[model samples]
Structures are given as structure tokens and as C-alpha cells.
Target chain A: MECKLIRPADLDEALAAREQYTHDALPIAGGQSLLVMMRNRLVAPAALIDLEPIEALRGVEVSSAGISIGAMNTCRQLIASPVLGEEVGVLPVAARQVSSTAVRNLGTIGGNVCHNEPGADLPPALLALNARAAVRRRANAREVPLAEFFTGYFETVLEPDEILCRIDIEHPPAGAAGVYLKHAISPEDLAMVGVAAVVVPDGKQTGGVAEVRIGIGGAAPVPLRAARTEAALKGAVLDAETARAAGETAATEVDPPSDPHAGADYRRKMVSVFVRRALLQAARQIEENGHGAA
Target chain B: MALLELKVNGQEVRVEAPDTALLLDVLRERLALTGAKRGCETSHCGCCTVRVDGMAVHSCVVLAVRCEGKAIATVEGCGDGMELDRLQRLFLEHGAVQCGYCGPGMLMAAQALLEQNPAPTLDEVKKGLDGNLCRCTGYTPIFDAILAYGRGE
Candidate 1:
């Protein structure tokens, strides 16, 4: 299909394209994903609403609340944002591990999640922290919990006319410690199994477990919540034994998908391995690093 | 069709092409900057590496429209005549290049590494060039070339 390139300078111009062209128009932020898909013939639209001209969509703002990462912010930007990095180093650490320098410079964090690749690094990390995804539909804007944003494999709940304006990560929750671990088959391909674990300590705990959130992907169709693992460890004291149990629970709970990249067994096994490593990693980070989001 | 005005090497050229135009296409077809070759139309091969605003990116995967309002540097722009850039000269001196098809992309990738980290360790150099594939297995000299040039040692 023939397509036209449309550059939108403001929210009004972007919304105008949405109202008039609808599905034919897609908001292009960074163009790293859309351009590649278009080139590969996997995705084609009749028109593109390039968002880079909208300066409002470019800067990274850190506040007392958390980090508000703009839609057009590239991985390069995130890697260089000292404020965000110090507040949330997990983001840049994950961004740098995504692919390579060339790809990282072009790929945007918004595009990474917005594309909703099941094996993507940010989704699991974002979900692990319960990051809120802010979507703009015309004149209205709403924040959707990350868990609800993804509906299925290669699918998102985002309306065709709406665009993900930015991703609002809540200030590292008190005692929040996070890490992203994945089984990468190669430097270029997506994860065979990715696990992100964030531990939000339940302070004043007398006996057992600190609160923890574990998110695992590439094993399942959508990046999934490790509810069983979270349940097993919650209110229970975290020890080597408890961490081990949580890892096993995560592996057993998530229904891993099979593909050319990895078998179901491999993905499932990695669920146990990566989640455990991620948990321990997060635990160590909290203990050694002191409080997060200072 | 899309009308884009971009600075190729150092000169600004205006051209009308399809929205699907790759930076490689714009450089090779319209503005006559062909030093950046197109290897794999897909990004699997790094034959199309170029500097967009100073970081190396795959021109094959990059949209030409994105190049507008940004500085683009190709191997052709690095230096005049055969003098080449330091990395380029080092690559030849170290015998890093073989067959010469992947040379442009290799040089671009190496140049990016040196610019950001002039003293990358061997592992860092290896990590930096992970995206660029050299089919001839000429990596030893390539690694040596990058390390030597980056440190001026």
C-alpha cells in the first residue's frame, strides 16, 4: 500500500491525524520499530505521524514522584540521563543489554514496550515495578496499569487512534530493589526467557517475607505476573530456602510458549533460573546499595 | 513520496523519494554518497553503518527522513584522499579488512566505539562490534586495529 509521511508538530496535529485518518495513520516515535516493520513488510500504514518534531515528546523529566520518560526518548537518552539513571539504574542497565549500540541508539524505550514484543526487556521490568503507562486519546489522557496494557501475544490494549504519550515510572517504591535477567540466544535476538524481579521491602517486619514482585516473559505469550511466586514469598521471611521456593513456583506457574528459538522446557527452566538470579540480584542490590530512588 | 533535506557528509541536498527510502538509498542514489554500501537490506549485516548525529546506526534499517536536521557522516566523509581516519589507517595497517565489502561498515562501527570510549578493553571492543558481522573471520587484526587506534598506543 502507498503511504504518506506526515510530520505533526503538536498534540493537535497528532490528534487531527487520528481523527481524520484513524487506522491509516500511526504515530511514529523514533521510527526504529515502525520503519523496520514497514521495511520487512510485517506492518504497513497509509500514513505516518512522525512525533520527533514535537519537542514535548523528547525530554526525560525526573521528579519527586518518579521518572516520566517521553515517547520519543531514545535508549541513548535513557543511558545518558544521570538523574534517571541514579534514581533508576535498572532502566539504563536493561537498555544497554537490549541489543547493541547502533540498535540501542535507534530503539526508543516507548517503542520497545509499545511494540509489545513478548520477549522485550522493559516490559517485565516495568511490570515488576507496576509502572503506569500513560496513553493519550485525542483530548483525553489516562494512565493504565502495566499489567492491563498487554492483552495477548504481540497485542496491546492501546486504541488505534490513541498513542502512548509516555511511561510514568513511580519513584522507586520504598525499599524497592529491581533487576532484569534474560536468556539471550544471541546479541541481536529477543530473549528466550526474561525475568524481572523487584523487591519492595515491607519495613517493620517482625518475622518473615518482604513484599516482592516477579515478572517473567518469553516463557509465556504475554509478559506475565508471577502471582504464585509473589504469593508464596509475601509476608514470609526471605531466606535461601524461600527464594528457592519462589523460583520454582515461577517456573511451574508461567505457561511457557515453544518456538524455533527455544523449546518450552528450556524457557520454563530459565524461568526458575533467571527469576532466582534476579531475586537474589535485587536482594543484594538493596542491601549493598541502601534505599532506592533517593 | 517524501521530500527530505539532509546534510550528507557536509553538504545539504534535497531529494524526493518514497517513505520507504533507507538512508543507504538516499546516500547512494540521490546525493551520490555511495561509500556507505548496502549489504543486507535487513539489519543482520552491518554493511550500511553510518554516523547519525555521531552514533553509528544501520543505514539499512534507518529511514532517510530521520536523517533530516541531523549530521550524517559516512566513511567517505571521515577524511580526504587515501589518508582516511586514524582507525581507517590502522585497519589497513593491521590487515583488519578482507574482501573490502564489510570495510565501510566495520570502519563506521569502529569509529563509533573509539569516539565514545577511546580506551575500550578487548571485551569492550568485542562487545562494540557484535552487530557488525565479518564473514572472513578477520577479527583479530580488526580488534588490534581498533585497540591501537583508540589508545594511540
Candidate 2:
């Protein structure tokens, strides 16, 4: 059977097309992974709604509240945006490390998130930045916190009739530093363990952190925040011992899967190792810059 | 099948293809521009790399319909069609081609990189070609070729 192609001019029309097709059609953004999946027979859709022609899903907007990133913004565009560079520096850093130059040229943040691949680079960084996904369907709209967006392996909370339009991230706290670490055999491979840490310094105590947010990927069914680990590190002076203990706690929080790339035991160990390294790197960024200047 | 009007190698052309036809297929089979090799229909190998609007993308994963109204440059467009380009000459001088299967894709990728960064460090060259894999030349010669091109050798 031949698959139909629908190109919508605007977001509203895209949403309506999505509503009309529902499960029969899949919206293709960049088509980096979706087309590959179709070729491999992993998925067979009756139609594809091409999201490339919609201008509304294209640029970045900065406001006093935070940054609003368009869903169709390619990884190359994210890496080049000066606004993201100044406001949320870690996003650009993580964006640069996604796949390879060829894939980055066409891959978009919306497709990455909606695809919900376990080892994806963006979710952990976006989660640590406290990002929210703005989803719309016809006349209705809603925003889901990035933390609650992913449901399971290659699954998200997105509905068949809805479209992920934007990702909104609030400004980081003053004097906070963010760092993302990826462990993989090759640069192009999905991370064996991906860790992202955002550290906010406590103004009262030198070398003390008021709060810490840790987002982990490739260690569990979905990219998730290390809540218990974060609670343990809250208001604590960051030292090597504290960082090590936080890594241990973060590793305990995840249920990793075993695959040919990595065994379950190996992935768990890497989770511990990378989380500690990421925190130490983030703290070092604070020490070097004096406050949250990193 | 849909009629696709595309700009390729500095010319406008039209072809009738399936709506979901891959850019690699359209370029190689329909347009007869076989310079972009077909290897690993999956996006892993850069053998199918081509420049769309001056950016290198794995054509195997790109839909031909999506490329309408965009400028697509394949490896066939590398030279003036008579003589080898400077980058191609550098590849030969540096012994970058062994089996010669990955040559065209390498040239397109290197050309895109140089257009963006006229002078690239050795590490930058490696990262620029990370998508491409060459089992024959062990990659050192390819790297040497790109670096030499950057240095105007």
C-alpha cells in the first residue's frame, strides 16, 4: 500500500490533520528516525503529516519568564542560537553531542522528545533545566513537565490527536552551574549512561549547594530525575564524598535494562560513575566562575 | 506518486516518485545521479551523505517530497564535470581512497565542512567526518586530505 503525505501550512492545520488521521498518520519532523523505522518495518503508518512546512514551529523566543523553543528547531539551530547559549548554556552543549553532524543537521528537539528513545541526549538536559512540553490539539492546549512526559521505552504522554509545539524552560537560579556527561563506546552511538546535573550555590555557606537537580538517561525505561538523590544532596556542602554518595543513591533509583551494548550490571555501574563525574564537573564550574556564572 | 521539483547541482529538475521515496533513491535511481552510494539504508553509515541547502545530511533517511524547493547537491556536482576538484586531488595525493567506495560521500562531507570552517583543526576534521566510516583507508589519510585542503596544500 502507498502511504499518503500531507503538508500543512500552519500549526492549526497540522493539528486538524493530526485529529483527522489520529493513529493512522504519524507526524514527521526531520524524519531522521521515523523514516528509518519505516524502512526497517518497525512501523507502518497509512499517512505521514509533514511538519517541515509550518513556520509557526520554527524559532526561539526569550521572555522574562524563560525560554520557549520551537518544536521544529533543529539540533544545528539549537547549537547556533545565541539566546540558548546565554540563557541555558547546557542545552547547546548537549545539542552538540547528539548523534553526528549529518543527523544533527536534520534532527529536531520535538522529534527527539516525542520519540522518547531511552538513550536520547536532550531529555536529561531538558529535565534538569526544568523544561515543560507545550502540546496542542485543535482548540485545546496543555503543558506537561518534562519530568512527567516520558512514560516508558520509546513512549511519551503525547496523544494521537495532539502536537508537541514547544518546549519551555525557566531561567536557571543565580550562580548555578549545569553539566551533561555521556558515556558511550562511540560518539555516534546512544549513550550507555547520560547524566545531567544543575547545581545552585547556597549564598550563606561557601562551597554549599542550596539545591541540585539530576537528570539521568540510558539507565532506565525512561529518562528521569533522581528525586531521592536530589533530596539527600539538598543544602549540603558539595565535596568528593557527597558527590560519590549522591551517585550511589542515583544508581539505586534506576532500573536499567540489559542489551548487547551494555549489561544491566555494567549500565548500573556507569550510572554511578557518570553521575558523580557530572556533579563534580558542575561544582568545578561553580568554583572556577566564583558563583553561578558557569 | 508525486511530482517533485528540486534544484540539484545548480539546475532545476523534476521527477515522478512515491510520496515516501527516499532522497537517496530518487537521486540515484530516478535522477541517475549515482554518485551518492547506497550503503546501510539506515542513517548510520555516511555513504549516502549529500548536501541539502549547504548542510550535510544522510540522504537515505530524507524523503524526496520534503526536499522540494530546496537546493540539493550530490557528489556528482563536486567539480566542473571535466576535471577533479582540489579536494579530490588532495584525497588522491594523501592516499585517502583504497577501494574508492566511500570517496564521493567523503568529498561531499569535506566540502560542506570547509565551506563552514575554511580552517579546521585535526580534531574538528574528525568530528566533521564522524558520520562517515571508511574501513579501507583507516581514516588517517582521509583526515590528512581534509586538513591539507584546509591548509591550502
Candidate 3:
């Protein structure tokens, strides 16, 4: 990679360096995936703008509006952070499944989301959280919903001069319980089929399930919200039968591609299987929470 | 290549290599510290793992340029003076060093794991070393070694 090591102290400086350089230059944080791809010669950047020096780009804070996760925040930091954990426990829960502690310590959420890989563990949870990303280009900043961020396979809306600056997640959906489950061949391996489910009940589990939301990943081009499944589960009693039905509904809608990890048919089957697993997981969490509150 | 400055085992220095060159190559070639081996070019194998800024990372996939202004601990930095780190001793006691290609990275990973959780359970031990690939199927012995060390046995 043809390169210059640039450590800009602020967003402006970082943007300035990027504007002066070509698209071949990459904005780097954590370097867990970026450096690996570079070493593998999959990415040859002409320049690398290191993001660690910018202190403002490092933190996990909860405000009245939502939770703001800095771009430089590492996965390990997110997982171990009591502040982020309590503010948005789903993120911490998702972060725990991101490979080993070593990878988590060095891999940043911004990188994972920005890379826009469907198999990544964080994106499904982010999608379920209704997360949005703040992108910066020169003096301008705009927020893009996570669902709209991915344009195609391995592609994102990141402009040449822009960088993913932060992730903003609105307060937890009322009665929302989020769960992410994946089928992996082994530890440290990518998921064969991953599923994330978010259930937003009306209030306490006093009555029946009011509204439930679901997302499925590792079986599509991007993490997907199973509208059919959600429609099937809406207002239904959050019981074994309903949850199982939602899983089966999700399995029918997903169009999986054949990869070395799994065949398309197997992936489709896992969609149903994992959705059932995720829904049951979500239901148990909600039941336990209500029990604890009582 | 880019000129980068960083501390290795506590000393400061500057070096230049292909900006995309991995920290593993920098340590093994540029600085001539052969203690950290390159068993698998991919990060899946912890044979190239190292502690950077007190956290373990796959050096084989981390750019040397990114190592700038960070602290690096390689296998050479272990067993200072005359004594091996507790994890290293445990590996020897349990015969976990078969082929020895993955020894340095395993020890580094284990050291970081045990330091974080002195008394990790058997599951925790397995989880901690999940990044490593022991081709000899020597995982049980390694787990035993780390568990023994973890429990101070």
C-alpha cells in the first residue's frame, strides 16, 4: 500500500487530510479488519489517517435523546463498559459474541458497521436497535439510518471525503428485549446463520405481546427485518407456539445464497431455526425482566 | 512505507516498512525479533498474536504503522532476565508446547487472559484461547496447563 501515516487531532484535520489525498487512503481505527485486509493485499491504501488521536471520537455516552457511541470505541470497550451496558445492554450483549477478547479489544464498532459486512455480529443488533450513523465530510455532518447505510454487498454510503463518526441509538423501545444468536462451526469463525430479534411489548408483560420486531442476518445481502415474521407475531401471545410460528414465517421469506459455510437451503432452514431460537431467547429475557421488576 | 515510532518491550524506536506491512513482519524482520513466529498468515491462528498497549492483537493483521505511539509486548519480552511468565511455565509443565510454532502467541494470549481473570474457569480458559489454532490437537493439554496456572496449582 502506498501510504502516509497521518494522525489528525480533530475531525476537521482528519477531513482535511482526506480531501487532500486520494480515495486510496483509508481512515483507520482499531485496525483489526482493515490491517488484515491490507496485509492480505485485498486493500492497498495510498494513505492511512489514524483515528485514535482524536479524543472526541472515543466514548459511549447516553443522553436524553439516545446513546452516542464514538467511532473509536472498541468492541471490548463496549462489552466491558458498565455505562454503555446499562444504557444499551443490547450492544454489550452483541459485542460479547464478537470473536475472542483479543479481537474484541482491537476491533472497533465503527469499523465493523462501516465495512458493512452482513456476517458481522454487531450490525444485526444495530439494525434491531434502530441505530443511525453520523457521517462527517469536511464541515458537514449527516445522520443515516443503519438500514439505508448498506447499498449492496460490501458497499456503503461512505463518500470519498466522509468518515463514519459515531453511532446514535434512540432509547430502548418500550418493553423491548433484544437477542442475537448465531450458528458458528467453531469459535473465532464467522457465523453460518445469525438472527437478531427485538420485541417491544406494550408495557409490563402484564397482558399479551403487543408489538414485536425481528431482524435476520447471515442469510441475506444485509441484515434484514423479517416483516412477514413480525406481522405474524404482532399482538399474538408471546408463547412457544407464536414464537415458533414467527420463526417458521421468517424461514419462508429469506433468500439465502450458497457459500462454503452452508448451502442456501440449509441457511434458509437455519433462518427458521435461529429465529425460533432468537424469539425464545427474547421471550425468556422479557419474562425474567418482568419477574425481577415484580 | 511510513516512519513510525513506538515502544517495544519498553524502549522507544522508529522504523520504516511498507505501510501495509504487518506488525509481525516489523517485529520479526525489521527489528529482528524472531520470538513471535508466523504460523498462519491469517489472524485466526494466534501464532502471530502480541500484546499492544496492554491488549492482545493479531500482529499478523495489524499494520506496523498503526503500532506507532503504542506499547508492544512480544515473546522476546517474556521470560525477562531468567524466569518465564507463569503461563509459559504452565505450558511447559503440561507439555502444551508440541511443535512449539504456536507457543509465543499462545503464551501471550494466555498471559493477557489470566492477568484479566486470575482464576478463569475451564470454559473461560477455552474461550480465552479460542483465537489460537493448535494443529496438534493439543488444546486439552494447553487448557490443562492454563487451568493449572490459573488456579495456582
DockQ of candidates 1 onward, in order? 0.62, 0.92, 0.64
Worst 10 residues of 2 chain A by lDDT: A285-294
Report the C-alpha lDDT of model 3 over A171-205, residue by residue, as the tens digit.
87655677878788874666777777777665644
- What's the ranking of the predictions by DockQ, best on top? 2, 3, 1
Instruction: Specify the highest-lDDT model's number.
Output: 2
Model 3, B1-153: lDDT tens digits are 567787999989788786556788899888998878886676778888899887888887787777778889888888785997777787888899888988888888888888889989999988888888788845999999988986787
Order of candidate numbers by lDDT, starting with the best: 2, 1, 3
TM-score of 3: 0.94
Error of 2 at B19 (Å): 1.2
Clashes of 2: 2
Chain B vs. true chain B: TM-score for each candidate?
0.94, 0.98, 0.92
Residue A281 lDDT, candidate 2, scale 0-100 = 89
